[model samples]
Target chain A: MMHPSAGGVLKPACYAKPLLRPFGLAWIVMMSVAATTQAAPEALAQVDPPTADHSQFEPLQQDFASGREVTRACLECHTEAGKQVRASIHWRWEYRHPQTGQLLGKQHVVNSFCNNVTTNLGRCTACHAGYGWDGPDFDFSDDSRVDCLVCHDTTGTYEKAPKRGGRVLQEPVKVHGHPLQPPDLGKVARNVGPTSSETCGSCHFFGGGGNGSKHGDLDTSLLDPPPALDVHMSDAGAGLECSDCHVERAHQIAGSRYQVTARDRKGTGAPGQRRYAATCASCHGIEPHPLGSDPAALYQGAKLNAHVDRIACQTCHIPAMARGGVATKTWWDWSKAGRLDADGNPVKRHDADGNLTYWTRWGEIEWGEDLEPDYRWFDGTMRYTLPDQTIDPSAPVPINRFAGHHGDPAARIWPFKMMRGKQPYDPVKDRLVYMQLFGKTEQAYWQGLEWQPAIASAMEAAGLPFSGEVSFTETRMAWPITHMVAPAEDALACGECHARDGRMAELTGFYLPGRDSDPALDRWAQLALAAALLAIGLHIGLRILFHRRRRHTE
Target chain B: MTRTVVMFTGLERLWHWSQALLIILLLMTGFEVHGSYSLLGFGTAATLHVLAALALIVVWIFAIFWHLATGEWRQYRPTTRGLAAVVRFYLYGMFRGESHPFNPRPKRKHNPLQAASYLLFGVVISPLLWITGLLYLGIDLWSAPADLPLAPIALIHVAAAYGAALFLLVHGYMITTGRTPTAHLKTMITGREEIEEASQREQQPERG
Candidate 1:
């Protein structure tokens, strides 16, 4: 027998006593079944089930017109959540590096993909956690603008209109030939729960304008990865979501690219301990290999454990990035953009693999599937090339210089998805020029197909000087390869890095036994060995001749 | 008159043959680890090399104890006496079909030159190889002392490996210098060697 009082839902005032018991019992049973089917076992284990039946809440039950209206109602209960989120990097899009004191984040850094976010605020802010960030004057202190449902909505229908400054549209609209239907705001608000990979990936997975373009390690495939692709996040494996590793506290997420945990010696924390890092060591610990009872396994384990100090786990574990049937944008040539057909319309080209190779406005893009990552020595800190910073045009400029070397004790050899590009730079100023790549205005590069107006307008908006002359300069950005980790059995074999022309061949300042050898030493050793063999052969030859001569004389 | 004498004990022959097998295994695996040629693959070569080295160390421990306990250590106590004659015989007299300047007996198995070379290999080369090999294997256990990085250790280990190879090659050739080409090998295998009766009569009882 079900107790009517035990039901989470409140009995409506108009319901009669007889109807109340059955209705409450039926509602409870329906919710229980829904919860059982909706949440994965691992997700339920990590996150507590929602205690509040939000459908019964008076404010959420209303027909919400705007996202702000829903946020206001959410603030009525989660008062401090708004303030906490408003101060987060997701909202501010700014992070002042602790070591270098250089301000970086999505807001300040100019990426090769689409350049700066300044003139393309409406398009870029669609991913931002806040609302109404269409211009520089958008209020940062306004708590009501902080989006609660974006990260917390269990209703998968929640979506921000791409060009509407992170606002959920009330009316249906079409942009980029894809239909953008308005989400049921009341249902989304009422069903708000813990964030999952789907929620976090709604923005992150689609960064750099399209899916799997910005980060090779992150893609839509990670939403439901298989064991071979990512053992931790796979449904058949740990089934861990983004928040399981990128733990959040008071709206502040743990992981950041600006300051990476390149080498973690902290090891796995004790049970119930708060973790603030998404490093492999934080979960796998220092000794990750299995120390078997047998001798051979013990030897392998010890030898592998020895490498933990110098090599980051991802160097071997990840094997390759963009491995889940999604090709990552590896090369971008903005110089090749601005191509128009005979009709003066923008041109688009697709490759044999159905990948977009060229778009008139965006330029040529080279895709890579299951690509090997470039290795580098990294010690967490990354110094960015700020918009105002000058650069020498002699070589490819690094977008963010990794602050580490072979001599640095804290540094380890890390794997990175190297995104190489050729973008416009001011010849006179010797600095990278920002372009208004998106907008409806005639000055926008996508609309006008003119570089001068776009660069000038974006530079003016960013309060930076842009020389009239522009020249394309090669640039490189290194995104640390830390996700899509393969299983242990699929780790790199010894021969992969131990050969003469192997993965570590380009690495200098250190010596690897099979890969490196001193030519002079080798030549001398060979000579000495040959000499010894020759002397032994000559001595034996002389002895045989002497014995034969003596026998003939006798 | 030539007569067969007990030149090597059972334990000494066991140690010699087993040590030879271990060294051969070590050489094959060691060169592969140095990236000379990949026969058994690097991982397998490295593992086998360590296993052979460990086995060699165990054999050495037993051989050292046997040598000390039976007073056989005196055979390798290097002496200057007859050392010049032995050196000169190998350099000039051997090619001229001259008889060996040094004779082998039950108590004194090695010539002066052989004693000195064996002493150098036993005390210096062998110890160096073992210590460096262990250090290489136990690299995870200790932080290398200042001024001594892993490169030098690996280099020294390689150099010592070359020394071991040379020792094996020279030792192989030197065994052929016996009265018959296979005489020394036969003696090591059978624990007996044909020697002059007068030299055997002159042998004193061994003392530790």
Candidate 2:
């Protein structure tokens, strides 16, 4: 429960103690709040309170040397736990998008980060749920393979060693000249309980190789955010768990970054209550403003509702994300990677916020905080370029392209974090290659330092013929910002949208009164009004002259 | 002999002033909605504009029924017999101390210019303003297609506004051109005007 403090102080020693659980009486209030927003992981759907402690059980009483050995003993009591984990998307790294039919997930899609996990399973599977998926021969049907402790471990000591085929290291080793401690498997096995934010945030908060590298909205700051930082996640405020709105059933979480809810034709559940869609509209209807308060309410409600036909809820609600003071990765230039320091070791540099700004193994990097999102109409669909798909070598490739614009009826303008990366791509074959990133053989990019053989071996394993020609291609990807929702009072003011140079000026296509003006129409209207006034002037002059003439004649 | 001529009924004066007040209110709020000037926020301005327009329409309906039921529509009937003289009087004859050529009667009250101006105001400008305003409100409320060209509709509506504005300007001067500067205004308030006995008896109005 020691979600590292938002002040950038990460202390593993502080996390060993168990936090105050959503205890006896407050547990009810926390459950009621879960219907809308509650970050307490125990508030997740269908979660049951434990009847007996695992430490008291004879199965977990024995000392275990490996996580797999611990898993075998736990299966004797909880027979169905490992089977449920195997069926989750967390196990199967591929998901078929319901709307686009595009097969995407950590396995099927090719992103600028670590490219693909094909040849890098040793290091990448540190985040994977099952063991021995190093070369895709791992059995999906094995129930004993799922690591239930990854999510269920209440003990703070469970740590998986990177580059070990997803196994917890049983021995201490040095990593980049730093001493490492092996996780105590026997202690972790005895302490299994309902998941907490710390357990889920373990892999999620440090994605894309470092803290706040992949997802802009998530970072160490969310561990213990304030109401001003994130109203929903702040333990001081709503204290919502990620699984509350992203309600999980069995093991499949409701929300996905791969597929999102752009517009909710189905309005909110109830006033001030939450739904399980992980969307603002799941809690607040399109008509967010109260009606019948004034005569304008009807027109205002309709006007705001009309905007929902093309703009997303996050466009206004999450004005700027990554505001929790932890900087997110904004740019990555892989072309500059592989630069050695004075001692010929891998050079690594950090930014002011302690984010990885540069690394000899990766590239020149940029990190930023409180960033404004790039607004685009996204109808909840993203077109991804798969590992084997043909790419256009003539232009920069988009790892994932956001869809929709003004005229698209079903599309809504959503806010996104546009990340730019320079990665290796096959020029002659027009495809991206997965290098043997962590292997110690001559084909590994890190150990062998040979790009040609490394890519050839990777492409051969992926069932694609390599052209032997490689080029560093600039790539772009957009991640939508749907978190760090500000309070309603902090939402964009009218002048922000309706001014001469408004925030939505270029993004929105309409004749906004204050923002856009038709000079031709304006000129004509002004002339006609002037003519009417001029006619009145002529009438007065004529009347005065006639009156004076009459007086003279008399 | 004491002579008095009934110029306006109390209901007619009430309708005239109330309609004027409503139009003025509509104009104030309507311009703000158009972003021309800000008297109130757009949301409030647009609501007030629609409400005032609706009230004006209701008042117009009552006035129309009163004219038809009471046979007061006959007073606005035009004749070409003295049309040129009336025009000339407004132009130059008034400077030469000449009398108005047309005589007033209950059944045939307005001169050709007055009848023509009122006809255009009621049939053309008023109708155009009402149609466009309603169409705009309908579009805003999603009752009509949102893609309708609001620029042209607004242009026509604003033009009609100018027409009403012109009527107000000229009407202001005409009231002062009566027997005295305040004569027409006083008659509108009291429903009577002093006139020669012959003119008053020449026409006996069939009162409703």
Local accuracy of candidate 1 as per-residue lDDT tens digits, A1-554: 12222222211221121111111224233334432334233345233445688888888888888999999999998889999998899999999999999988888898878988988999899988988899899999999899888899888989788787999875788765778789999999888877888999998888876888889999999989878898777765555678767877888998999999888887655544556777877655666665545666667766887788889999998899999998889999999999999998899998898788999988999999999999888998999887689898789988888867767878999999899989999999999888898889999998999999999999998889988787899999989988898877788877677777778878888768777777777778778888999999999998989889979998
lDDT of 2 at A208: 77
With a 3 Å backbone cut-off (N, CA, C), the pairs that clash in candidate 1 are: none
Off by over 4 Å in 1: A1-48, A169-180, A539-554, B80-101, B144-147, B199-208
Q: For candidate 2, write residues B84-172 as lDDT tens digits.
A: 97898877676565655656545565678788778778888899999998886766556486668666777677767767766766676
CAPRI level of candidate 1? acceptable
> Mind giving the per-residue lDDT tens digits that candidate 2 earns over A415-435?
888888888888887877777
lDDT of each: 0.81, 0.71
Model 1 / residue A26 / CA error / Å? 34
DockQ of each: 0.45, 0.26
Candidate 1 shows a clash count of: 0
Best by TM-score: 1
